[model samples]
Target chain A: MRGIRIGVCLLGLALALGAQDQANIVITGSRKYQMAVPDFNALPGVAPDVRATFDQVLWNDLYESAVVNLVGRSLYTAPAPQSEADLDSAGFRQAWSEPPLNVQRLVFGSMQVNNGGLVVDGYLYDVTQPPGGGRLLARRYADPATTAGARAIAHEFADDIIAALGFGPGIATSQIAFISNRTGHQEVWTMDYDGHNQRQRTNLHSIAYSPRISPDGTKLAFMSSVSGEPQIKLLSLLTNRLLPFPTYKGMAETPAWSPDGKKLAFAADMGGPNIEIYTINVNGTDLKRLTHSHGYDNFAPAWNPKPPPGSPGQIAFVSSRIGLPQIYIMNADGSDQQRLPLGGYAVSPSWSPNGLALAFAWVRTGGGEDSGASDIYLWYFGQQKYVQLTHNEERNDFPSWAPDGRHIVFESGAPYRTQLFTVAADGSVPEQLTSQGSNEMPNWSWH
Target chain B: MKQSTSRYFLTAVTAGSALLFSLGLAGCGHKAVPPPPVPAPAAKPTPAPTVTLSADPTSIESGSSSTLTWTSSNAVKVELNGAAVDLNGNQSVSPTQSTDYQVVATGADGQTANDSVRISVTQPPPPPPPPPAVQPAPSFAESVRDAFFDFDKSDIRPDAQQALDTDAAYLKSNPNVDVEVVGHCDARGSAEYNLALGHRRADAVKNYLVSQGVDASRITTESVGKEDPFCTETTSECYQQNRRGHFVRGQ
Candidate 1:
């Protein structure tokens, strides 16, 4: 009887080990971890403006990451932690009060005015920890008491929290170059990635579009129609001077920079009435024709951000050779061309940084092209399946990827009232980046 | 200890069954992986525009001329690289060398087609014995006239044809003079579009002169678009006067 009991116990242990395979607790699909960010508490002598600015800016930056699901403040049933000292108090127990609220993490901070300057203390805690200790991240920033300085401090702190949580280096420090018509003509205007510090970069006083910032982020290349031809022009950020590229006889537009930044590929009418993809040296030498579509317009060339193994290079471009516009991938030298398995009026192909997927604007067609509205879609090369990122909203086009690879900026509008907007790569939490005037063709900076 | 053993046994049994059920539900274990298809070459869905070019006289004297006409039904716009003519019009071309004029037509559907017409200008049958008398001096200034266009149209208006005819006559009378037709547009729409419209306007003037029996080589064209408006004042009358093709003599 003793031997039988021992045998049963051993059998139970083996079965339990087999059943508790951690991977078996499978989620249907991956999702953002629920995170709660309560408003930062103000120190006894701190001004309300300082507290409000820091809290709002930090929340905006963190929420823009899209990897974390921010919990609403109304659900918080605990007292707000005022300072780092409060972490030692029982009053801060609310940070980990989880159950009814399924938040997995808590973000709280405090701000105070010291010597006419604002000082902020930021913290992030894991809700799964016990009340005594759950500090996952903590940082402090000091800045002049100006509103802009306060906002900058908050952005820096939010970046710290994101990096600590391993969500990739944050995009808060990046900038976006977009075409805006605020000065009565379409010119290149740049602003902080979150839509602050907007200033005009080009005053061509003519129409310009497709502003692509170089990898070094010092120069901008765009297609301007000021010289009576749709020609590619470059603007120096250091000097604010506009330099025209070597003149091609026909119209030139849609300038794309190669990953190495040594070459610019654009659509030119060099061969025929319809444009073809052509690559020219940055100094405008060694012009090479990449496509011969037999008079079918092949424009909008987007070089792959990362090249695959055993190939010179690869590019994702939109070609209208099949009667309808579709995304096509080809070697950089224009060989081994094949179309993506998509059927629609698709254009504006932007390759993801990892080269695993392509984000493009697609207007679904039902035997005819004019009926459907344009929306952004992601085509996963690995899965060979696509998911629509935007649905039945305003027409969203020109989906350019952010440097972090987790976000995309695109133009959204009907016709005359277009604005720039940024969204997560998986298509969530779209934040309007520009609203003052008509903005379009936003290209995220490489850094 | 005995109770703990019973509880462990119960939990193990439940978890083991759940694992087995999930594995069974997964079937072949990969719902997301589908058979990959070999990429094939893209299908060519449609052909480019079809064009035809024919020279009216097919041959001309060394200094004389012949008309070259083209017809393209599928195309919305046609371009003669060096010569300016409408989508379906004729131009009297007198090439010093035997010249082949290629016309490319771009359809509204974005397909292009091209054709060429060669005009054989005969080598002047051994330079005719010269007439000993002196020729009259080249005349200008009075014959150079401004031609107007309709709102945005580049075609020569019925009223503007008279001025163009006078300019054509002056060029015919003085074969030694070569002129440039400068095109302009009013301040409206996009600058680039205006530039293109301006070029078309100048080209239309050159084509009209060529059809009126002026040597095509003697007329060059340029478009300043809305940049060099003849009238800078912001008024409807000024804009109307600015939309014109001006004639200028080469130095």
Candidate 2:
């Protein structure tokens, strides 16, 4: 009897552990959590088309998150469970009769139009838990019954679901600003996180490069050769107003806004013969020179979004003082400078939001006869090492990190054209984002 | 008495000339006094164009100005050093070293004449205070052996010391000459970081020179990073050659 009781207790503990999914997600593995997203059931007042649109947008959002390997409805031999009552009645175990539909998680939702607004209710069920009930998370969102609003509502729920799965947050709401020569000149353009609803931001009618969105997302700073020389320009997204940043002597390129949004640091040929790092306030006051190098050109300053404790001020930038260009870290006031132990040509660094790592374009050609092509690399500050995030493919450059610190949007091209591409932080799944025209210098907006 | 004698002589000559004229008119055999013999037509010769060239000061210190004045006569055109000029005018010319100004004049008959003036430019005399012991001027690029560093290092290398030593020795002798130490890097690494690294390399050379009896004030350092490489070839030797601290004499 004692032996039987002990065995029963061990089995019960094992079942409990299995039911509880891991809350902390380590994104560096190949084991993907299988997820199923079915068309949302339309209530009487809701048009079936609206419900279909909601389901489609939500499914795409979850699928593009890159972590969830979705199972399509074609794999299911039986009809999908639409409502909570239906799911409860049929039991979660009967939701899918097909072998592949037995996913770890199942997403089912319902949509309806009520009082001129769209209401969406979504649920995530850990199907491995129990036979009758397997609900892990649920959320309800309402918005005006418009296409854009409905899509936004779905994205909100998807973001919440992603957050519950230990991912930082979904980037569905963020936008990427990049330079595109679609209209005969390189202008700053912004598109939704998934490359939808692209709109031109700056009509400078001139070549623009390196669009940096403010942390608050109200202002955009970019370098434009509009005034016949490259100068930093700030645009107020709220008012559609554009103003030139008061600069000293030479041209300014590569503007990066600080995490606090009070200052803008950029690479400009000012106060010296060569390009050096300078910071100016958003209101065009308090100009400060962060570097005093009169010889070697220093630029591409990326302010750490999250500096380590006791060092609230830290910046990573590219410097060629040694021989080739290498990444260097300095304090906010340009002190305590140290080189990141990376070799070869590294430039255009974009710091991750979490400040644990930086993404940059690097080529490891040791000045031999080989002209090494560039690819994206991630230098993990915590690990004090680098990982080549791209392979020996086309030339890649100008990496920008998404707010979630998971996706990096960069530019890749070979012969006559280049386009924007987004890859997971782990260097997997490089998805081309832009194709119509030559695009370069992609910057992810702050959420 | 002289006036009376001249009046009487004029009257007697007038009567004789009248009798002669009457006799000639009456068909008497008499020789008519011929008018003074007409002078043969004199030939007018074409005048050759004459040119005058002069320099106010034939010899001057280098970079000093001199006045060159020239006048040409009977000339339709005048040119100074292949450039047309006024027939008579003065021009101020500063010959850097020594130069010759030639003036050519063409007369109306297509005849040409030329003259030249030379201005010798000499170095300014040494100061009254006897010059210091003569020493060769420093060769900026040659005197600095490029203060080469190891891969990705800004520290001066042992092999590069000879050049820096020569630079320091020259700098010590010529205390007034200031030099600029420009740092360079190979075409690799982050351009911004390479700039900072290049700065450190130039600073390293400057510091070393200062330590070796060269005045710190005589050295200013800058870095071109990898933007301006000495050698663009992809060879290791080229990269090593590019990673250097070049020397430049400052004004």
Candidate 3:
């Protein structure tokens, strides 16, 4: 009798382990986990427009996450659960987990207006769990009762859902800093990742461009002509004012922040013969020159988010030291410089979040009929091969990697009227994010 | 006495006869010594006067005057518009209405030659108002020229040298005026590298100006990369125009 009991116990343990493995497959497998998000219930006193905004933003956020395959609304057999009580209904689980709507997860919630503010009760359920469904997440988000407020709540809820599903962090809440001439000057502007809440952040009334947001998103370092010359200017986003920075002779441009947010690596001539790379502390001290080549131009420094073992970090920059502008990587202190073997002209190197690959603009054949068109290419450190992301398009340049490392934002169009666009890392689903005026130089937030 | 009378009568008769014969021959001989050939009264000796009337400007704007001139030859008197005037003269006339100016020249034989010119006049247009104030001098951009470069090159070209020379001359002439050199590039190539290339172009321009005896401190450099283009067309000429080192007056 004891042996039978032990055998049964072992069998039960083995079955449980197999089920857990299945769950693991659902979380981290090659195939995308399917999810369904029905409309969130709007309680009394909730404006229709606010509810609509919330629903649309939430759906778009999930769709653009590119992690889960959202089941179309047409396949939804049962209405969305209005509250937590609806999760106890077997029909809800059966309708979502059965064929024609075979989604493993469901995100349903309720929104209301409380004290002139928006309140959202969001929930995520694993519909594949037996006995109705297992609840994975429950949270309440509140903000001002406006469309923007609703959008913010939706973004937060979508990010929460993405995190609960085992995807690292969603980029729904991140912002993209870009240059826009909509205000008649190339001022620094920012927008949500899905192209909402576009707000101009500068009024220099002069030509200001090449905005690089600090890693913490608290400061912005950009090139501006407010002082009648192109100099690096820093602005505190939290204060909406200019921060004091020392001005150098000659032209300073393309300021990139280090990963730790303690230093800025930029290109400047500083009355020198050629433009070279330099690093300075965030407080505007400890100026160190990186490249020392004479008469050979170097600029456009991008720092790797993660450096290899036993190294402070690596910086990828563009240099004409070898005659044509090519992408080169070196230690943060500007030592051990090595050029990637990309034959044609390559510039604008943006390191991916993983620090294993670089996205840059490349002209595969230089100085011929094919030289005029440049495409974005990704070079992987592990593979040592380039994968072309854009093909035969207009002048595409200034590629910035998204925080998720799954998408890249870049500028493409005629030189005079370029606009910002984002595409999946695999060169899929290219979407234009800006259409007003000429927008360019999109720097995605580090977060 | 009878015999003497008879002889005297005969003599008288003879003498009378002789005298009569002599008278009749004298009359025939004197019949006509034609008045010394009067030369058929040589045809009148009068040449008709030739006159020409013209206006310096046949057409004139209203309120403007045209100079009417007349010239005549072989004319004893000349009349312009029924008023006697010299055979060759000019008069400034502001005609209120369209009028035909006639010049008649009278010759010595009462012969006349005439010429006429028409001057048309319309209502005068309103006068243009005076300029409000003194016009401003040419802007810095107009006074200073931009230096252009070839595709993907920052080295000073021959044409760029001429431009920089002129710019340097301007800078030297105006010591108080500081300037900024902005480098630009065509739409082709990467934007970041273009920024760097633009910087090189601007630095090259500054160095050239400094070498030409202009103070380096008076000049600063900036690169707009391919952001702000002077030319927006896709043609090679437009691209060339876009790739330039522009000059801006410093404050």
Candidate 4:
């Protein structure tokens, strides 16, 4: 029996890996999985608003995933199935699988209020299969019966559907940290990937910049002037308090987290004439200098999200060695330094979650001058070419890739009055994410 | 008595004959010589020549050039620095040292008027006083002036060099005083890149001070990027004013 159990586990792992491979193909190819999502049914005692909130959030999450093409509800000729009994009906199957709709998969769910909390039951059906064999996923989620709770339940359900469909992890639960002076002082602020639940994380009362979330989502490393000098400060997200960090002799700014969440790469002068890159442990130990060009300023280091096995990840940073700052890649230990071969002014590089491309702000016309406005560009390593992701935007900068690898969040607008915005990696569907007083420097969470 | 009278008569006759011969020769010449040309109005004195000379940039660096311009009226001839030139013109002059350019205007009546302009040339500062000996310590505001930078540049400009030289001299004399140089940028570039640029500015200042014989340990550097700008206007002059390396007394 033990051997059989082990064999079952191994089989499950193989199936998951196979699904992941198929999902990659779906993402890279021109075709997307055609699926239909009907509004989740409200069982007795479920508030109408709760059901509406869940349905809206779930639909948005799926659409933004960009891995599936959702069929419009206008094409539905019959009512949606809300339970196994309704799903097994021949009429429901015919409506979803018919030529006009031609949906390959269908997702439906039910919501109910129990013990003053919300409970959601979701299922995915492969309509191409026979009615008895169509069910592919079934899961239940529970939360407080509030609007936020309903949204949370919906997000969880959508993430589960995405995972089962073989798309890697979903970004519905990720957050973004940015700088906003809405409180009359520059402070660190965070929001959900969909620009919901904006909350201030730091009350430093002093200016703060570059809030980078840790890989484990437990800490936020940012540069602040709380002590009257700019220094890297680590804050415990779990504890909501500033942690102890060593005070270097010079200025420290623009801290980036290593993938393991164990180290941070930042730029500092250290009582010298040039700002070079350095790495330090999260606990302020094992300080290592990564770059040594004497008179050149090197900064804004971004670690590759995933490096080769048993190898230190590569770091993309801005260097002004050959005049205007340009993107340069070096090993985490500062070896194999090479420019990215892009001309004009390039700064603020952010590595894509897959580590195959870099998203950065580039002024293609002006060489480090204010005469030209900045736009976001992506340099794909494999293709050896660049894709312009923004155009004719006024000073769009600080491009941070979403964990899903399909979206990037950046700050845009005129100087001193900028706001945060998000755009798809393909340069479509630009969305404004912030409208308060002067927001800039958005860093997306790793998860 | 009769003989004397006869001699006087012969002399008078000789004078009369000479005068008649000269008059007959003039009449034979050109239609009676036009009655000896009427001597009528006296001429008005030629107006005194008026001249003005000036230089476009009255002062310049030794190797640089300045333009000398002169305008004169009612003058037949004009000379700049003893060389003939147009009455109303400008000439570029690169003098090796300080020079005074003079313009002389001469009227048709030969009356001359003179005007001059002085162009001051400043030589490059001597290789920063060779490691100045211990001197009296000047106040921070007097000695440590802010070093300005060009847009997105960290290389030391000549003016910046002069400010830093004075700062270096002060730092060398005051061995116990520690200073912090904070770099800044205009609100035009990405915040992250501006931070790096600010650091470059501060570093450049510190390096120049060190090269001038101030101990490196007496100085530190910081970069506030564009967060703490000195000026907030959107003009180029304001941006330039915001981009600087500000010096502060170390805590």
Candidate 5:
């Protein structure tokens, strides 16, 4: 489509303002990343520095999230040249081993001090359990002190791994948002989700975290520490300018925007022990309260947007009440609190836009090796059964429904990298999203 | 050892079955236990034992603890990945990485109960930032033209956003300047609808500038539905391009 721009019509803040106390605004940081997976276990036996470990963990987390599959290492070990005349063969094999494969493969690598501060060198391989083999993808490096040095090292290798395999790379192949401790404090950082293509979005050198993606993934809403208190700021991926959410009385952190793009709800300490849910217009006005438990702590209000049954407005939210935190359903006006049967405990509720059911993480009170492992489940109110999605011993939460509602994205980590995952509505076929730094708080937008 | 338990029960059941058959009963495999009789009516009663259950603190790292905590001391098995990790009294793991701690706390009677904590152990910090992404900017005129459209639609997409951001950057950098906004829509709809749609597109752009904190006095809007077409329409693209709000010179 030909580009269209809407001119600015500056109307002073709407006159019908809900007056409140003087806004003492406050804010935030991120352990962030994204990268392509040439090898799912590339960093496994590699050096264990903070960067390498971050790359590895980010990969594991993203893989476990089920957003994408980690094919193998970015670069694979190739047979060394027999002589100087074999350069052409070596290069050809390297290029051939870099893409997606008919036969799935994995590789591993490490980053360390070389020439200066750091350098990443790695390899990819072809392996599919029953039969295993190796092919060299590429040999890449990162100069010292570069933005996402480790991630960049990982990204190139991932790209090569993709090229060799014959298909596109996943999020490790795509970009991601996160928080990191560069410039001294935490700020929203970007790198290939697999830990490549790293850059800093918030140069406030202050602090920022809890990044929320816009419906189209062009903008990010995150909590910032630039003004001392955590303030929600909307940032443009294209422009790199920061738009702070209008100030509030206390702190405005952990923001979640609706699918329609008119409202943004955030966690604020309006006047309680824990954060409460508050919604505001994108222009930062018309603030409304969705919950008023008086004393009970409540945060994480996901806008369950199928528009309530029969009625025009209602939503499902997760709250801590009846002793333990559980899923509760209510009207948009904070009426009719019905507890959902999510077994022992359920938090981090993600509502599908089509509103067929709710997907949440709950503690599985059964035996096996997963005592601490959280299982993902779908609360099919229509079916009256809890369909379990993930059955592994990993920490999985923050389920974000894709615009299609067929796929649910979330964060998973065994400390690999805390990346994103996408699973079908029925809880089958999980794919990873990111592979590098920690990509957390993934809120998917409608296409 | 593996067969002993089953064989013992089988032998006992077989002997019992033989005795029952000899007594002229049909072949009997295993007999079910009878239900307990109703409790006797008594005022004086001993209280059921109070099981002092203590939560086992699984070895989770100091940071990255789940938002919840448990202190049960006499729990049965602690869950790590998912399956049970057998633990004695109070056991904990300092998982530097993300690990699930599923703690199965048992009551005084060996009937097991379960609780779990999903812990995410983050690794160390990463290196400095990567270079900024460098997407070639569309030419200045191409960008400005895309920012105009009907109301209530961000359907303008990326190309438009990019173009608007460019103009916005110029305006923001160049102070002491203002602009007039003119909105327009196609003639296919009623006058009111066209005007409304035009206003929405106009307002959308105007709001974008305002969010950038553009001066109110510097920017204003007027809508003209089929009122004026800067370009005669042949196709929808031309029609859409004409049905937009643009900024003229100002303060």
Candidate 6:
């Protein structure tokens, strides 16, 4: 790690922060601007404990994908999408369906307890009509390691969502990195999005938090108190060596990597009054400050929807500029501060892979670390509208959007331990994704 | 940064201990100080009676059951409970009905006794099967024993939240079992905390189960913590564990 910055002088800091101006370049494009509800029929998030509730986070994740649409199979009556009033007026005789079920694609699953573990059978269909209308597209099985499965199951659904959308099924088999306090010490953890095969990545005696996976899913950049200061460490998943942000000062908190996987953007005290945002190379060189909000703290960053061959370079982050926390979209550089006043004290702003939408935690009424009640919100760039995803009373925050952009992962301290979660972009499937530990600061990595 | 509080505490304790140790030596009667009348070397301490102890079962699973047994010669009393069991010897050999068993030992010289024998049972191993073929329909109970709040409250009361957790754990492990969690509440608070309680309780159960490996599809939660009364009987003691959540296996 080489090349660092000295934030000792404000004037000097101003000079260095100006260098980031070249990074903020935005582009206008229209492909798919809505959260895609991909079919998660095959995707399984830490499988639900219901021997049969039948609704899965995968379905919800797919719903968020806005790819494949979901019509609850268990809820599907033969003929109609009607209001409760409309349904009653139509009578039980009204074949339950006006909008065709499985019209775009059919995603169905069956769960059963087998030999002490949950055995799930999932199927995908390409339906043009109703009932037996679609041809079988693909199939998969999810046998929770035990009756209790986890985060990996969501990966299962994510896979099906992809397969259902005819994307040749990728990512259904990748891993996500998060933070968990399983060993009595908070450290970096990795588990399938469904919350399974949870393994600790860092075993230092100090508590580790805020794990953000690199674009290629080969590395993780997170904060660790191991060095006696909250410093940033880039960990190689393949190798066990730790790469601390070469000799930076103060605390480095939340972190995000560039789409190219060359640089890391993180928030740190950097010997200042407020925790601000900064970025550096993977080698810890060229330390660049992203913001200069003297007294206000700015953090929670996500690369703006970088797709493959054709991708726009943008960045979305949470900042408390107007006296209240909100989400802002900008160029990779620190310029063109466009605000999407989320209208609430928002934290953990996660940009979708496509950059069309953003997921965040917005505290509605009164509830913080003391009260435990908070909600998650989704901001759609296309609709220019914010949708509430979580209505539960538990405090939910730290959102991490899936590589696909339809799903968001976060952590909450409900009755259960403060752990990770994945919700549909619509916030419908507010499924808890961890067990037995205080898991927080989740960052999604690419497959 | 790694908050190695234990190490920090250890260092502090070590430094304090060193200072105290030195001060203790420094004050160790180095200067001539008159010694107080030493009690006539306490009457030749009577030889205490022999006490023998042995666990009825020496081992047990971390959470399983076990009993202890002990005998003391020339002792008047003894008792047993978990750890060293209890201190009194008045209780009976309540073996069949108790989970933790203990024994005490004592001596009757000026007269008292102490006794202890701790026996722990093993983790209920796939409960000695009904035979090898009938696999236990693995009961996964991912329930929340602590009551959680909604919006703005910080309290974890005990109640149905317990059973609700077991049900959740059970359901989480059995993905095939769809569960409809009906959240209930005792008559109390703004209808809000209760509903929120009910919903929170159910979500607590749902979240716990989901984390435990249960598929989300098999579980759904709702709250009625304050609205649904188990009995209009108007009693707080009876509504203790009932002031929370309930999980019903969904069809």
RMSD of each: 46.4, 17.5, 16.9, 20.8, 41.2, 33.9
RMSD of 2: 17.5
- Return the lDDT, model 1, position A431: 77
Q: How accurate is candidate 2 locally (lDDT)?
A: 0.74
Tens digits of lDDT, candidate 5, A4-114: 111111111111111322111000001111223432222322344546544754465444333335444534344333322333442433433444332234344545565
For each candidate, report what fraction of the true interface contacts it reproduces: 0.00, 0.24, 0.51, 0.46, 0.00, 0.00
DockQ of each: 0.01, 0.11, 0.28, 0.26, 0.00, 0.01
**Model 3: residues with Cα > 4 Å off, grouped in runs:** A1-30, A367-371, B1-147, B158-182, B206-222, B246-251
TM-score of each: 0.59, 0.60, 0.73, 0.72, 0.38, 0.45
Predicted candidate 2 versus true structure: per-residue lDDT over A1-447, tens digit per residue: 110100012233233334444212125334567888877777888766667667888887887777788887777655667666665554545555336576777788888888999988888877666556677778889998877778788888888878777677788888898888888877888888777788888777775777888999888998776774457899886675796568555456678888899998888775345668788888899888788774566778889888889895788887767766778999988898899887777788888887777888877774233333577877765445666666654567889998877788987764226778776765545577788878877889888
Report the C-alpha lDDT of model 6 over B138-223, residue by residue, as the tens digit. 44343324343332221234443455456555555555667776666553222222333354455556666566567777776544
Note the B-chain TM-score for every model.
Answer: 0.44, 0.45, 0.46, 0.45, 0.39, 0.35
> What TM-score number comes out for model 6?
0.45
The clash count for each model shown is 0, 30, 0, 0, 127, 115
The local lDDT score (0 to 100) that residue A90 gets in candidate 3 is: 61
Worst 10 residues of 5 chain B by lDDT: B46-55
Docking tier of model 5: it is: incorrect
lDDT of 3 by residue, A300-396 (tens): 8999988888898899998888887889999999999999999778888998887877889888776323236677777767656666777644777
Off by over 4 Å in 1: A1-30, A41-47, A88-95, A113-117, A130-134, A243-245, A270-274, A281-287, A366-372, B1-251
**Runs with alpha carbons beyond 4 Å of true place in candidate 5:** A1-186, A189-200, A204-209, A364-372, A415-417, A425-429, B1-251
Error of 4 at A322 (Å): 1.7
Off by over 4 Å in 4: A1-29, B1-145, B162-181, B206-221, B231-235, B247-251
Worst 10 residues of 3 chain A by lDDT: A1-10
| Pairwise TM-score winner, candidates 1 and 4 | 4
Worst 10 residues of 2 chain B by lDDT: B1-10
Candidate 1 vs candidate 2: the DockQ winner is 2
lDDT of each: 0.73, 0.74, 0.81, 0.82, 0.52, 0.54
* lDDT minimum window of 10 residues, candidate 1 chain A: A1-10
Candidate with the larger DockQ of 1 and 4: 4
Question: Candidate 2, residue B101: CA error in Å?
Answer: 55
